[model samples]
Target: MTLLQSLIECLGPSNVLTDADAQPYLTDWRRYSTGCAVAVVRPASTDEVAAVVKLCAKYRAPIVPQGGNTGQVAGATPDRSGTAVVVNMQRMNRIRDIDVDNETMTVEAGCILAAVQQAAREAGKLFPLSLGAEGSCFIGGNLATNAGGTQVLRYGNARELALGLEVVTPQGEVWHGLRGLRKDNTGYDLRDLFIGSEGTLGIITAATLKLFPLPQTQHTAFIALPDFESATLVLNRVKKAFGAALTGFEVMSEQCLSLVVKTFPEQRMPINCQRPAPEWFALLELSDSEGGEHRRDGFELVLSDAMEASEIIDAAVAASESQGAAFWHLRESITLALAAEGKCIKHDISLPTSRLADFVRDVDAMLLARYTGLRMMVFGHLGDGNLHYNMLAPATLSKARFEQLEAQAQALVHDQVVARGGSISAEQGIGQRRVEDLRRYKDPVELALMVRIKQALDPLGIMNPGKLLA
Candidate 1:
């Protein structure tokens, strides 16, 4: 049998998927790039992965590395060629080690992010990298994208949480660097090279991740803000008051909140009393080593001071864990709620914290002028200046026309982002979807350097082609 056939048969029928069997896995999570692959391979161990890669390399077959396939930017899907072999890492899920004493956990690439968080919690530690996709996204994908979530204000992104990595290079050689050391000061930080490369440089087989002490108490509150400017003011106030204890500060528009309530009736808003939906809302959370009583008092005092300063319109604090979770649930469900709407244009862009309010105003104004009656849903980790500025078509526009204008809409949005000295693609890496547009924002020198690195690592251009640098 041929190498590809041999690979499919050796990996077991269950682990190896192809044709109709691989249909679901071949497509992008957002259903944007519906590509076909020769096969989707799921290896349960590092050795098996190395063997598969070696076979693919011998056959000169391109590979698309996928984990959880939960990415929004079509990063994990294969192209339409139907010649690429997709390496799906979900079967490799395993938490190898949890060194509480060292404050680190070594886990396989395929492990779901939520599972890792639960493992840390069970060890009486905290794994703070969080997002709505935590339940379905894999740690490998998070590392590949350098994902930043709500708690980035406190802990940092996946790149910061990563201590070491075990990667399978394009040549099918396994580079094992899963050391739990905090400060190695090695010659070169090679692990970082692959972290945000979106599986172009290599396939991340596993990683040694940093953990933190679990917060003994957490206080969550939902507050109404006059606008994005006031949301920024509230964030600054809470940061000054609580410092590192201020764990999460998210902002949402009244339109976004209203959609969530209307779309998902099971979920309830967190306000103690209802008022005309304010222009904007903020989800503020605080975590401390102190007990619940101290956390409650601290959060309440901060809100009172902010209210006195007129930074907030009104607020409601969570009285119990369930209540706190409910507040977070509303924040986390924002994307899903918005997805229920018809055709949408999504932009995960970032600007300086100081420029965010102005940037939003200008972008919103520009888009409204170009696309009349467009419904805007702007919300995200306001603390870190990353907003999921998405626009939905008015009920009048047909889905076909809405999709056809996506390219033009993206160009407009990206132009504004570049003019503001902001990133066109923030948390989400430049997968195939944004590869061409990347040139508009990326410096030519930097792009050339990236190309050189790709040449050096995957000289044959066989490792996850048509992604990131393209």
Candidate 2:
């Protein structure tokens, strides 16, 4: 059979799509990259996926494994060449097992992050890898990128939460390594290799994820802080007081909040704006196994102490569940609001808590000094040191002029990030977006080791080429 015929035969005609039908898988969420795929294959089971991949291997055709396609970076997007086959994972959605006693869940790769969270909740547990794209982004994509989100303060990254993974190797063999054990000192950790490899090494078929007890009382609050320094101070105070119960701590500039409220008027500002809007806003959440009254009391006490110390200028606590959701709705709207603005240059960076406030200040000052009249929007998970620093064109500049400064702005911001002993790409993996950045900044020895590993596993170089490593 012909390659196309072979794929169709292996996955059924309905599962194999081409031409205009395959257009959905061709582009990325941000429209940053668009590529042609000879066919977009949706396999229902691990066996079907392995078969399709084996067929591709026989034909020497490349495989680009895609999940949700919600990543900002074009990690999952294919190249302009149409010779590759796109393996869409949505059809593999399934929560195979939820072990309540062991506190783990084995799930198919295509399951949406939000669906996984809901499944955990239904089982009286919590899957806490909450991100903006949770509603659509797949767990496989999360594993591929090693996604980090708001709850990293308490729960940790996707790498930490995933106990084991089932991956389809480059040669189409299924490596079933989904072990839920907390301690297994085997040989080299192959699971960690694929966790953040951006699908360059292999395709993750499913994962065994760790779960935690659902919080009995989840209190949410939005606090207005004098500046990033004060925001950090408030975070330290809350962390010391609540310890593990402090589930989330987020920070946003006043300008960032303003843009969101302007774009989505329905998303009312969560923080009280009594003191000239303050310089920064911190959204705090405390999830305790204790009763609501205890959680609320503890949350209120921290706020009172912080406010008295002038760390928090003003604050507003969520009075109801709907109110808490509304607060998060505002936080999530920041990304949408940014998109509505003109062309923007974004950097997902991380820094030590001690240097984070200073890094933000220095980068803002540096960018403004160099690119006069440039608009910036800064926000992120302040608890875990990730910041979404973005730059936009001043209203006076046209889109073309704004984009023209992306390179210069990116260079300045990223350099400052590194200077402060921080990472240029924090939560967002080095997909196609910043592959060159990874090459430029990553250590020579380390990069060589990564390339060696890639060569060792995918000698044919068929697994999602042109990502992570240059």
- Give the per-residue Cα lDDT of candidate 1 at 227: 78
Q: Candidate 1, residues 1-470: lDDT per residue as tens digits?
A: 67667786669878888778888898787788888887899999988888888888888888899999989889998888888899999888999999999999999999999999999999999999999999999999999999999999898889999999999999889999999988899688998999999999999999999999998888889998877898889898889888999989999988888889899999887774456668889998998887748668877998999888888889999888899999888888888887777677899998888999998888788888888888889899988889999988876777778777777888888888888889987799899989898876799999999999999999888888888877
The clash count of every prediction, one per candidate, is: 0, 0
Model 1 misplacement above 4 A: 272-275
User: Which candidate number has the best lDDT?
Assistant: 2
Work out the TM-score per prediction: 0.97, 0.98
Worst 10 contiguous positions by lDDT, candidate 2: 270-279
Clashing pairs in 2: none
* Candidate 1 lDDT (Cα, 0 to 1): 0.89
